[model samples]
Target: MSTQINTIPASEAVRSAEERIASYDWQEFATELSGYGCAVLPKILTPEECKEIAALYPHEEHFRSHIHMARHGFGKGEYRYFKYPLPDLIGGLRTALYPHLADVANEWNARMGIDQRYPAEHKDFLKQCHDAGQTRPTPLLLQYVPGDFNCLHQDLYGDLAFPLQIAFLLSEPGEDFTGGEFVLTEQRPRMQSRAEVVPLRQGDAVAFAVHNRPVQGTKGNYRVNLRHGVSRVRSGQRHTVGIIFHDAK
Candidate 1:
């Protein structure tokens, strides 16, 4: 018997995403990420694509697992991890984004005095994660109803973790939801934590540090830990797609 190969159809969403990424001002993005520990990319997804992803939240077949944040003390909402052979739209974003972020990750690792440089291709990095026995998918879609929220936390799944991750807002801030803003907090050495609210409109995405980032200090570059979450939603509903490059155990 001959084995048949199944190919995914081309997605306009993915094509558009590639074009957007290709046009990004990496120099500016790098400067922003270095200064603030995060960077924003607007309109990575179309409004229609956002709506489509949000609609997929209710379909269990598309996901490998569902997690209730409140059950784990993570927060009050829920999220579902995409199964292997992730939808083309999601997979394309991951593939298109990896190389650029890998460069930044390598740079940050060097500056922070850390070892382990990422590969130029995302597949090579995934092989590393799988070799370490982390075989589960980590990209997920999060849904929040009114009064729902996520607590500040890191997305580290296993020892092998990518330095950065991205989250795209699927719902309009005021029209589809309210008060559920993306939040990032940094813990500086010998100082109180500083919090930043990242204002995101529908289709806008934020690329942020997964754990710690290098910050220049009087002595030298120091590592500042980062945690991200969502504020409580006061009304309507909120949805988002989180793209994590590393797999889970």
Candidate 2:
């Protein structure tokens, strides 16, 4: 007797991710990021895909490190950072999304008068981070329950940082969870901090600045500091996957 095994090809997964990413209006996304410091890509992943990724959260072999947010003053939930060999879907999305974001990152640096620029390809950029002693992967899965929340923070892991990062909501809003809104805050120079509550449904992704972004002023472009977090969950469970391009030290 012969046994049958069902598995999807890695290349096929990557190609699918690339095709989905290519379907979005990236120019509009870039414009939105330039203006609001964040943009949403609706239904970037299918509901089934989101569930599959979220289900990986409980498997220890898929992660390198597990973090209890409260223990580290991060928040009330927990998360795990994926190891070197990220899951195919996560890896594929990371690779496919970087080039488009790289263009925007370069433009933001130029506007902010920063000398740093990212490479056109994700692998080349990862090499830069690895050479700088940031060899650990930063992609992670986060889980939250009722009364749990994430503190406002930047995902900077080293001196080499990607300006933008993306997070995908894996669970439905009204069905699987409630009151866990994605939030971003911007600190403008000598002025008040502005808060934005970004609404997201299952399979939706939001890309935003990791630390600083250029905001146009009367004279020239000025820099505004940005941080992101999740608001308190009121009921049920919430799962999310974050794609941070830069590795950690």
Candidate 3:
């Protein structure tokens, strides 16, 4: 069973998000970032932007899966995040988007008085990671394998920073697949679950922190940290375009 969202296009969503971000004031946006270390900007990218990215890659019939899990659940998450294959796409994205994303990241850093702001250097770091990759959630991508899933985990990649990442949901998620839901949960001593079965549409995106308490589970614990993962796609395939920001080493 797979649920499809006949929503807007990717390019349109990206354009819209770009427009919104362009006008967004860092001072005000910081409130949400401080609360949950993330915020959801709707219509982030239009369907067309999604297509433009897909068009760049010629070898896209390779939709596969990878099964990953954790202590929380059985069906954690599935891969096949983006149309571009690994390594190449990873380097391309780092080179292409890093420079452009720098201006915005710097603004956010300056406004927040963050100690780290190294978009240009980070681009080079990612380029070097084309072959050697790690699980710290850098500017790398993972392919999806049937019956495979991702488990809840924290994205601890660098020393410290704000707005650590901005991921693009290339696939429209829904209940059509058995699992494959974007389950985001807060981790506090209380262990409450503030999870949303958010299967963001292909043109939409949700950004979060590398470490923050999940809204529900953060009562008793001190900085329990936000954890998210995929639930597993029993039926169809899932795709995504993920980009992570980091401080230079």
TM-score of each: 0.95, 0.97, 0.54
Tens digits of per-residue lDDT, candidate 3, 103-152, equal 54555555445555654655354544443443233442343436767767
lDDT of each: 0.91, 0.93, 0.50
For model 2, give the 10-residue run with minimal summed lDDT: 1-10
Candidates, ranked, lDDT: 2, 1, 3
Model 1 alpha-carbon drift over 4 Å, by segment: 1-15
Candidate 3 Cα errors over 4 Å, as ranges? 1-20, 23-29, 52-137, 142-146, 158-163, 174-179, 190-196, 213-222, 247-249
TM-score of 2: 0.97
RMSD of each: 4.2, 2.8, 8.2
Determine the C-alpha RMSD for candidate 2 after optimal superposition of all C-alphas. 2.8
Q: Which has the greatest TM-score?
A: 2
Query: What stretches of model 2 exceed 4 Å from their correct place?
Result: 1-6
Candidate 2, residues 91-162, lDDT tens digits: the string is 889999999999999999999999999999999999999999999999999999999999999998999999
